[model samples]
Target: MKSILDTVARWLPGTPEIAMVLGSGLGAVVDEFTDLSVLPMSDIPGFPTISVSGHAGNILFGACSGKNVLAFQGRIHMYEGHSWTEASLPAHIAAECGARILLSTNAAGGINPLLDPGDLMLIRDLVVPFPLPRRWYVPDSPAPVARTGFTGFLIDQKLADDARDVAAESGLPLRQGTYAFVSGPTYETRAEIRFLRRSGADAVGMSTLPEILTARKCGLRTIAVSAITNVASTVPEILTHEDVKDQARLLLPRFSRLLREIISNL
Candidate 1:
């Protein structure tokens, strides 16, 4: 089996400054990349295979505004039945390949009544709310997700401020919030949503938390953004994966705008 570095080196010609993970319908963020070189996630020695619908499940090496970028088109979720080791590989691999920054995006259901569908949010913090701790993996170690604790710090404040500024300038506004990370292939129940809200969570999602933890652990500055695809209410609403994807897709122009500006600024 090839080492993670070897696998990345074989596909990427240059060290990427930014490593981005796209979620759900947000994979369209890569549509603007020029000089694209594709590497499927399945080709990676130990990365988790994507099992969800509406996720591209590939890694892309390309230039965005003359800056070398490594992008994961879709992410591996814990809900997909992946272990911590496999779930943490994307950030581990990106950092090992010399990426200085990790930018993660996800589609979340709004727990805060103020958030609306198609709203872009800059995640100020994350809540894993479970009794068990989140694990962090070392980038160069044999056991990628070998570590056992999470850092109190997750989002890079400076970068997040930059993102907010960029969004403001681009006319794609960003709402600031705490994201609730759940281990779920299922949408949150009404009671669970209430619990998250009481815990100060403004948005809720199934991915991004592990990757952000892994990124920060690897010494890469991290920034996380979420597109509010649905609003969670006490009254249950029938939400499907397609609804989440469609809402996210509708935010493309705005999401992509802030994304491009963020890259250029970085």
Candidate 2:
């Protein structure tokens, strides 16, 4: 693994202060960087290739809003037939590459009534489903329970405040909430959405949790934002990947600007 990191370092050749993982329809945010060096995930040893729609499947190293950064154009997910450890590899590699901060962006379904499509929500905390592998989850019982409690890094309050203020000034609707992660290649059913909302989740997505936990383990400061692509209510409307992609495209610029300003201020 160290050798794999060494290989990527040879290709990218920089010590980035910040590392980012762009999710789903959010890959366009990478365009904000100058002097970008694009590296296909396949070209990087030990990196997972992304196959989902709306993800660019590349790694970028460059200057964004005056800071040296390494950005992933897409990410692997547990729901994509990959294990949680496999899904977390990129974030671990980013930390090893010397990133002081890990910033992630995703397109999620709004579960909170206050959240609407195109809203940008800053994730203050996360709650993941249990029964995870022992390597990732810390058992709660003396009987050596395989499942663990919720685990992920909480974004610093100061950074969260800065993000909220920036979004407000930019006229972007910014909300804060607990993000929930589900293993998914499928969209949630109306009943499932209702249950998650009742459980206190504001947004729901397939990726981010494993990556967040990995970044935390590696001592990287982490912050995440979700671009709400749709309201996950039991409204009987057709929900498809196409719709999610379309919504993400519509909200890309706003998401990009919010991230750009936040990075600059950091």
Candidate 3:
């Protein structure tokens, strides 16, 4: 991990205070960068290749809204056969690079009644159904910290407020709620969605939890926003990854604006 961190440090032009983890089809936001260096995951030591569709698999260093930012153009998931630690390496690397604020984004199925496709939800809390696997032992590095409670300070409130304020000023209505993380290569069934809704989840997805847990342990303040890509199980239509990709692209402008404004406020 140290060697990987050191290698990434050398590639950085300057330390970034803000870091973003781009999810699913949200990678298009990287195209907005002015002075940028795109580092492919394949070039980074100890990083795994991203295999999922709609993920661009690169680390972008540049300025957005006049703030220095490190944007991860893709992310890994546990369902892809990576351990939680491996799935979260990007956030840890961002922390090592001196980024104090971590902004993560994901495309999720809307479980709440009010949410529709293309709507954005700010995660005030998370409900992870899968037992968060114990952090993997890394050579010469301290073991990762365990969260004492499920929702103990996962997303910082001040950061959430700042984001909301920015959205209000921009006339973008941002929904706030709990995000439930499921281990998935498969999307949820109707029964599962009903259970999650009963459990108080507003949106559901397969990513974000591992990375958010990793960011918290690394002492980086975190905030996550979910782009509602599809209605989960409520509608009779079959959902497809291609449908998720399409909706995410359609909502890029709102996502991109919120990201830039959030960084500016931070």
The most accurate candidate by TM-score is 3
Off by over 4 Å in 1: 132-152, 234-236
Candidate 2 global lDDT: 0.79
Q: What TM-score does model 3 achieve against the real structure?
A: 0.92
Please give the ranking of all candidate structures by lDDT, highest first, separated by commas: 3, 1, 2
Model 1, 135-220: lDDT tens per residue? 43335333322234554668999988988887788777789999988777778888888888999999999888778887887899
Tens-digit per-residue lDDT, 187-239, candidate 2: 88888888888888999998887777767666888889998999988446878
In Å, residue 156's CA in model 2 sits off its true spot by 2.5
For each candidate, the alpha-carbon lDDT, in order, equals: 0.82, 0.79, 0.85
Clashes of each: 0, 0, 0
* Alpha carbon lDDT at 100, candidate 3: 92
Cα lDDT of model 3 by residue, 1-266, tens digit: 67778888999988898899999999999788889998888898778778999998888899998988999888887777777667787788888999998899999999998999889999998886545444334443333333434446789999998889988998988999999988787889899899889999999998887778778878999999999999895767788889999999999998898888878899
Candidate 3: global Cα-lDDT?
0.85
